[model samples]
Target chain A: MLDAFLGWTGVVFVFIGVFFLFLGALGILRLPDLLNRLQAGTKSTTLGVVATSIGVGLIVRGWILFAAALAVFLLMTNPISSHAIARASYRAGVKLYPGTHPDKCEERKWKLPEDGEEK
Target chain B: MRNDTPILVKKITALSLITILMVGFFWAFTEMPKGSSVNVNNRVSRLYILKNVKAATKSLNSGNFFAKGMKPLRSDVPYSPITFGKSANLEDGAANVVTSIVVDYRGFDTLGEVTVLFLAATGVAMLFFGKRKKNIIKAQASLIMSVGTRIAYAVILLFGIYIFVHGHLTPGGGFPGGAVIASGVLGLFLGNDHYESNHLGLKLFESLSGMAFVIIGLTGLFSVNSFLANFLPTGVIGDLYSAGFIALIYIAIGMKVGAELSAVVDSMIVDTEEEWS
Candidate 1:
């Protein structure tokens, strides 16, 4: 019963993993802009990889489990690092979608208030 | 213009033809493995750690404290987890443990990653922070945005510090934490252009942290077997003092990354200034 349960859990994880991959692909295809696409790509892919790693851990069931867990941890970290890359890209003046609403960043200017006077 | 049009058209046609040919080749290679299953050797090697993992887990669960101590590091050499875990305990004095491993034990890789960050900061600085030859004046934002962002600044800053300090216990570490902290500064950059970072201090921090990284790597070569080896005592396992070399490496990486990212923000902000002369 326990063995069957483990096997079923493993199958479920694998299914989830495949589902995440499909979501990531769809996100990449459907997202409108570079930043939006990046958001979709990284989050979905990270979740997909983690799910896949967990599934592998269940299937292999040993030191390979530790390795799989490490892979999942790495997957989590990789996206944050990639997000930094994407943010850096945006700061470096990559354009947004033309029809998209004006960005908070593009319209905003920082200024100090002058002595309680309205300009 | 007329002559150039044909040349452009010819180039486009040739590029498309080559792309199609490449795609055809890829499709053909992908299908060749469809029906064929490569036989994999299922025989376990004597040294396969998978066999021992069960024993290790059992030892961990068993109440025999001394026997558990005798178990080898969970991860082997070339597999970084053990090295990171061992080193982090030794160097950082961090209690949660894993934070030290990622930051200190595999610090050289962390250094390379930091350099990538530095490069990114440089790129962002160049694009957004450079002195404007022409005055490109920006408009002020809505009160709601300005006020909301201001409130967010404090929250984000706190969150960044929380992430950095609690990195060992949780998923975040220096890289993520540093970026979070940088994001806080980015809030300031977006909200107010006049608030610029001190360039001199930023430069000093960037250079010093960068140098410290190199020095740390070199120290490993001189004191240990190879580069980035644990030159310090392993201490008692599972204690804060355990991973001697690892702790120091993590601290250095965290500080270096934090400072370097701040510098990146500084550079980007400074570049926004209009040329006075």
Candidate 2:
């Protein structure tokens, strides 16, 4: 009974992993801007990796579990790297949607105080 | 235009071919898992230590005086002191023993790590500082979002402090806590447009903490044979006041990392502003 339960949990984890992997690929293809695409790709892929690692960990216990934990830790770091890349792309003159307004970077010079009063 | 189209097509094809080749090579190499025999030496030693430690601890709790006096043999290569009746919990001064070891006993490695951090900060600052370009996207946060975010920011700031303070007793230490503190500043960056960090204070903290670390190392040079030796009295073991040089090193690391990371984040955010102007 315990073995069956473990097998079912493993299958569920694998399914979730596959779902996240598909979602990440779809997001990469579908997202409009570079930043949005990067976010989608990193987040979904990280989740996918974590789920897959957990499934693998459950199937092969002991030392393999350490590998799974390491994978999850690596997954957590993926977003930070992706964010850096997206920021770099933005700084390198990548364009975004036409409707976006009042760029924070542009308004830094003429920024008004929080209370709508001049500093 | 026609020539350019063909060139682009050829480039794309070549890129894809290379990518496929690389992927195939990696896959093929990964498939051959040359399994090595498990070296049970460390595991066996660890198990033996754990068993004995557990029994000793149990006996101590149960008022068995003989078992309580038994001391575990310290590893000789590492040269950890074998002080009897003192549970020299090296990791108690910092959550990560490895980090404590690297930064405290091996202060030289920490010097390199800090230097790398400093270089990374300077590099990012130089790259982004004082450049002006247009950013089209605008942050349109609602009033509720703005207020709630500020509250959350305060909570996270406090949490970061907690992590830094109890770093000796917890899973988190200076680096992680410092990063968390940096993220809190990021929250400000997200919420406000013209949020500039106090550059002078950050620089002062960075320089001072770094100097203190060096001074501590030099003290060890004068007092002991090894660099970053525990020159101070090793107080009552297992107490917070214990671990002579360990606590001092942790404090120095905490200050340095916190300041450095804050400066880095500040620079990254400020550089974006310069690009816009």
* Highest-lDDT candidate: 2
lDDT by residue (tens digit), candidate 1, A8-114 = 78779878988998998999999888888887788877878777777777766774567575664556455545555575566556878888787766678634333
TM-score for chain B considered on its own, for each of the candidates: 0.52, 0.61
Cα lDDT for residue B241, model 1? Answer: 50
C-alpha local distance difference test of each model: 0.61, 0.64
lDDT of 2 by residue, A72-106 (tens): 45554465456556655755668975655766755
Which prediction has the highest TM-score against the true structure?
2
What TM-score results for chain B when candidate 2 is compared with the true chain B? 0.61
Give per-candidate clash totals. 17, 4
Segments in model 2 whose C-alpha atoms lie over 4 Å from true places = A1-119, B1-96, B131-137, B235-238, B271-277
DockQ of each: 0.05, 0.06
How far does residue A17 in candidate 1 sit from its true spot (Å)? Answer: 30
Q: Which tens-of-lDDT digit does each residue in B65-155 have in candidate 2?
A: 2333233332322324433336554332333445445555456887788778878877876777774434333443334434544665676
